[model samples]
Target: MKIPKIDKTILVHLALFAVALIYGANYTIAKEVMPLYISPSATILMRVLGAAILFWILVGKKRLILSNKREKIILLLSAIFGVVVNQLLFFEGLARTTPINAALIMTTTPLLVLMVSAITGGEKFTFFKIIGISLGLLGAAMLIGSKTVSDSSLPFSFVFDFNLGDLLILLNAVSYAIYLVIAKPLLKKYSALSISKWMFTLALPFVLPFGFSDLGTTNFEQIPTEIYVGLGYIVLFTTFLTYLLNAWALKSVSSSVVGIYIYLQPVLATFIAVALDKDSLTPTKLIWAACIFLGVFLVSRK
Candidate 1:
């Protein structure tokens, strides 16, 4: 029997929701492995390698060959911005900054994406999208509580007294936003799995040098089972699955829509933490969630 087709819009939204949920858990899940069992460089090495291997295996010999060098260039840039810069900066930045600061800075990604897309002529700015991005950013601030800024994160006093680590995190957001915009054109011509697989594969070589020594020095036998489980989750679900989901969503939705869904990460992270008893549920959080929902709805409107 043939499987009935799912609506592309429904499928796209569902895929994005799954990506956000996976990322929400990843914030906590990844911590269980890094700085203890695996260094950030080594951890990223594992993420790229594991995801690369899985993607290659999933694609097998049926991989689509890009016929033009322009496609290769686009894919390479996507890999660098999406994986190399995005992951490495995040790890380094998070180490120097508190989660609250990182979360707030990262929430600016939607705005960055919108601005870049408009400037590049890839997207037309809309009133609803602007309001949506603003609302989502506000909701995120409310949920993460914007008051707790760490001094250590401030390395640069030249611009708004921003710290070095905070700058890196902001740059990471910018890089990923660029990746989404540049990669969107490719999505129109390739399967999400194929594009994702190639992006990770291309990213592997650039990332390998940074992580090799770290991975080589790690003591495997002494690492606990739980940490390994967390590592596996990062590689499989967070790295592999989320990328695929986002890519698939891109095939049907604009990059702005994909970017706006990031506002849900903190809201979902809060609820997940509550479920795990790592955090408490409060009325203020409920209000923030409503704002995020409204913002996402407005921004995602076609």
Candidate 2:
């Protein structure tokens, strides 16, 4: 049997777009399922468990090699940040915050990536990029300070107490940025599927404990069919498909190209949320979004 080769250029573009689209709509779809029918930890458990099963099914039979002890440790750490903490924080955050805020706050990841890259001496930050990073932070702070769906009565608490959900999501962004940095070297040694499968498998121990109680409490028979569909979307498209597409794209395109596509996520997320009436566009939000977008453009426009 022969697999026909598509043009790598076109396939790369489609893969990038697919990643953005899956992630963009996920804000609302994931929000709809969590807390209402499933706890955040339970959602993380299902997403990883389901995706892990599918990844193994796709490639589990093949033997994978890790070159050294350091690589193995890095793999474990990657699972912690990338799979366990990253997901646990994101779903919990999304449950408390509006989809718009979650999406908007996520735009800060690229900047975090750059800062970590600079700190690790993987890259240098120019003065202009620093300013852009500052502006982006300003925008994020503004967005966090703005009224959220979860805390309309306590707008100022974001500065003092901090909206737990928004804070968790921001932390999730930082963890993801760190995961990107940690996983880069491993990608050079292994295929993405192999690395992803192992990482998620290792993550199960960490994820299961937090989720077990919630899983036990969930009334599966009472859950609506629509929520199940939303969960399927999260497991299949957001987790599984997006990872494959991203890994495939990285083989052909620069990581910077992949990072640039993140800008689309917030836009699509915002549009979907607004259209669904799950979130509304406000003057402050518009102004802050502009700042963040412009800042991200400046920082990312190498």
Candidate 3:
């Protein structure tokens, strides 16, 4: 049967929008399982293994790989940065921080993506955008230096007092930004599913040792079934499905458009967190989130 033809522009936007919604829910869904019931290593392991298996099972022998040495290296790098480093840091960070904080911190990815893209010569940075970068940095500093969840803390004391989880999330953002820059060229040479399949397969080896150790200690019977549902969501929707959509979007849109979709993630994440009583929205979050949002707007605007 022939698939109905959709406009490329609409398809790209739809793909990105779906990813943003998935990621938004993911912040809360993922956090509910960490350090409390699952270790970061275990969670990352599940994500990597699940995604790899699903990609292989669903994609099967229909891959369109060139299999050149250069292509292999790019895929390897993408896997390392995109999955291995990104998942490890994000889960570890989420374990230590609240869902809202993780969501807010991830907004910096677009700004970081812009900077990485500029330095790598894939994109040009303007003077207006330089100012935007400054504001974004200031916003990140404010959010990171402050307490994770409270209104009583002094608001002006952003003296580089680091929160470990928040810092790791920032590093995750950096790794992901680099991944986007690295993966852009590969999309031209291969299909998104092809890149994803190889990326996760390559990442599995690097992540195995840590995840294996964590899995050994995990007592499965103690975990509630709801948590399993959450894990299923994380592995299937957040990790697997979202990455596919993101890759497809990246194929058609500029990185700027791709980055713009991220703006919705924190909004959806925050609302879900608040409604579920998983995380609270504080005055500081509002202030810092505003700074980041405004900065993102300036940087992304043509």
Candidate 4:
């Protein structure tokens, strides 16, 4: 039997969008459950552990081997940026800001990734890319500005309050971009699953301190069952499955294409929030969504 040539570009983008959809559900679910069961650090710890376990199971023993010291170091660095720091910032940011704000801020990840890539010589700098990034930034500004202006219930003070959440999300984007840059070198040495597994393993130690502390503060018996269920979903779908798909996509496509898929996340998050959390679907969100998608399309076009 012969296998047909797969369009890796399409596959990567689609996988990323699918991950965004899963993550959309997570924003509502995680927010509700995370505060009830555990602190942000603990939540991240469990997620990393669960994702690692799943990756181990998928890869099995024979294929799990690391080829060299460089591979090991790369994996460690990837874990530091992608899992440990990125997730810590993201959860903390989520705790600080509205989910809508978090979502809107996350749309900037691709632009940041492109910039980082260009700076590092992973990708060439181009005038079109700059325009695309500007459009994305404008979209984000429009989204946030419109939201603040239209929602009378929102405290005017919030606009002035330094948004630590937005800052954390921005930090996550930078950390994730760094991880992507580091991973590119290691991907040549190891399979994506191997790299992912090692990264998770390294991240596990970093997460343990927070997990144990959070456990000490919370009463195990008093925690609601829904929290466990939500945690499980985040571990299985968002962390494990999403990473696998993302790695597969990255193997096949250019980083720019992979980055474009991030723009879809906020749109998916907004819709999911409306359907599940009783959040309003505003005209501002619609307009911002259009801007973001159009900008991403322009940037990603060949």
Q: Which predicted model would earn the best TM-score?
A: 3
**Least well predicted 10-residue stretch by lDDT in candidate 2:** 154-163
Candidate 3 runs further than 4 Å off: 1-5, 148-161
Task: Return the lDDT, model 4, position 107.
Answer: 74
User: Any residue pairs clashing in model 1, and if so which?
Assistant: 154-163, 155-163, 155-164
lDDT of each: 0.78, 0.84, 0.87, 0.75
TM-score against native, each model:
0.80, 0.92, 0.93, 0.85
**Model 2 misplaced stretches (Cα beyond 4 Å):** 1-6, 148-161
- What is candidate 4's lDDT per residue for 267-290, written digit by digit as tens? 778778877763665555566667
Clashing pairs in 2: none
Candidate 2 lDDT over residue span 168-264, tens digit each = 8888988988887778777766898988888788998999999999999999998999999999999999998987787667666655566668778
Q: What is the lDDT of candidate 2?
A: 0.84
- The residue ranges of model 1 lying beyond 4 angstroms of the native Cα positions read 1-5, 125-164, 274-302
TM-score of 4: 0.85
Worst 10 residues of 1 by lDDT: 154-163
Q: Rank the candidates by TM-score, best first.
A: 3, 2, 4, 1
Tell me the lDDT of model 1 at 262: 83
Q: Which stretches of candidate 4 lie over 4 Å from their true place?
A: 1-14, 63-69, 138-160, 281-294
State how far residue 161 of model 3 sits from its true place (Å): 4.6
**Candidate number with the higher TM-score (3 or 4):** 3
- Angstrom error at residue 261, model 1: 1.0
Candidate 1, residues 133-184, lDDT tens digits: the string is 7886676555444332335666321112336666677778889999999999
Each candidate: RMSD:
5.7, 3.8, 2.7, 3.8
Candidate achieving higher lDDT, 2 or 4: 2
